[model samples]
Target: MLKTQFPLASIFFTFSLAAFSSPANARSIAIDEATRLPLVKRAQVWAQPTWIDNTFNFDDLFNPATAPLGSPDEQVLTKGTIDCTYLYEAPNGPVGANPKFKCKTTAQPSLKLKVKYGTENGEVRGEVLGTRLLWALGFFADRNFFLKTTNCFGCSENPVNQKQTDPNSATTPVSFSPSSIERKLAGSEVLKLVPQADGTTKVSQGWGFEELQMVDAPEQLRDREALKLLAVFINHLDNRKANQRLVCLDGSSPQGCTGQTVMMIHDVGSTFGG
Candidate 1:
């Protein structure tokens, strides 16, 4: 009789523990000021910022920088022809498996392209979807454009298979058959090369997730948690330090981020899939 009662008590205690630790129960806790994020509407997050040019900006358009800093220019390229000069292609990988290239475009000098060809399950579609969802939810996301066709000047015959001999040299032309790409995505992830007074170009290095702990008064704890939860919902498995970026909108230099810095996930390619 004593042994049976002990076992029953143990089972009841385990069940109670599990119930208390569940997410549903945890959300019941009272919200505090320190943890609550400021009032944010789902629609307001989709408003387009004024500054679209990611390159050089000297005019008064840079003033009155808004909160939730978006990329300089955030829009889709569906109308005109996208002519790009192939700069370089990154080494292939498994986690964020996709053919990506650093190309210089007429509109955006520093443009990153994700190409989808053959039978590849590339991240172009997933990335575009993920960024749009995040942007709609009031988060800074890369300005992505899906182009059905693009003219690649000085491109390799088989770009997807082209291996990089030297990743440092930007001018080294890997010419093939001048690739005529079909189904590609253009996004903004490169640092802005702002010209300084000393006749030199300055670029700010991006920040990692660990920097969130150093977040000042502008960032709330709930905001950070919301991002993490969103990542889970989007099935963003490759949520690493290199994929996330923290940029500044001080409008000074590429690295001049003294005013208001915005945290965004540039690489959402490995998302929206179970």
Candidate 2:
């Protein structure tokens, strides 16, 4: 009886494995030219499986109120006025000012901004226009959301969803965690690898651009393929500085840093119809 049962169980397990492992059932959604949609639209279509499970929502993170509103004299990062409250904590103490004036609740490892607006066609619209041009050029970029006054307050609202790669490798729609010191350092290293024309280089250890000499170390050549792709993307976007970078595990170890090379893009805020 035991022998017979053992064989039966083994056969059943084999069959179950075959059924579950079928390629048809294991396939992922295809990404191709024809199927390619704007990242925002793709997020909406695939939200349930791709974003919602990863803790993303349309109304939560992208709210205009969550973005800082600019002052009349200030320069806007994009078109329209972003809510100033989105940038900082309210001025008052516990009682605070108007509830509407208070900052929106946010999770840690997030991006924060200050209150300020840019000139109409100058700052705000220019950023947006530049981003749009970059997207058309086929570079990886960030999405910008337009906010209304009502949306700026805590009233029930949903802003347009834009889809961009998450900087966080661990999360969906991955974005870089500005809070992570290690990640920041990794971004700096990538900048050092890419070369520039002229005597000066385009990237540096700091946040913005500065004129620096280019290095031609042999190890830098190992990253040529990845760096070339990244440079093309940045140049197409008219990137003048190291804003954001993409990072991946080194090839040799796959699990550990080989010190060989990985790719990363930084400060994507200015990307995709900013």
Q: Give the root-mean-square deviation of each candidate in angstroms.
A: 17.8, 20.6
Candidate with maximal lDDT? 1
Instruction: Please provide TM-scores, in order, for all candidate models, with all chains considered together.
Output: 0.50, 0.27
Count of backbone clashes, every candidate in sequence = 2, 35
TM-score of 1: 0.50
Candidate 1 C-alpha lDDT tens digits along 28-76: 1112222211211111111232333466233322122221223443232
Local accuracy by lDDT, each model: 0.42, 0.26
What is the C-alpha local distance difference test score of candidate 2?
0.26
State the displacement of the C-alpha of residue 36, model 2, in Å, after optimal TM-score superposition. 31
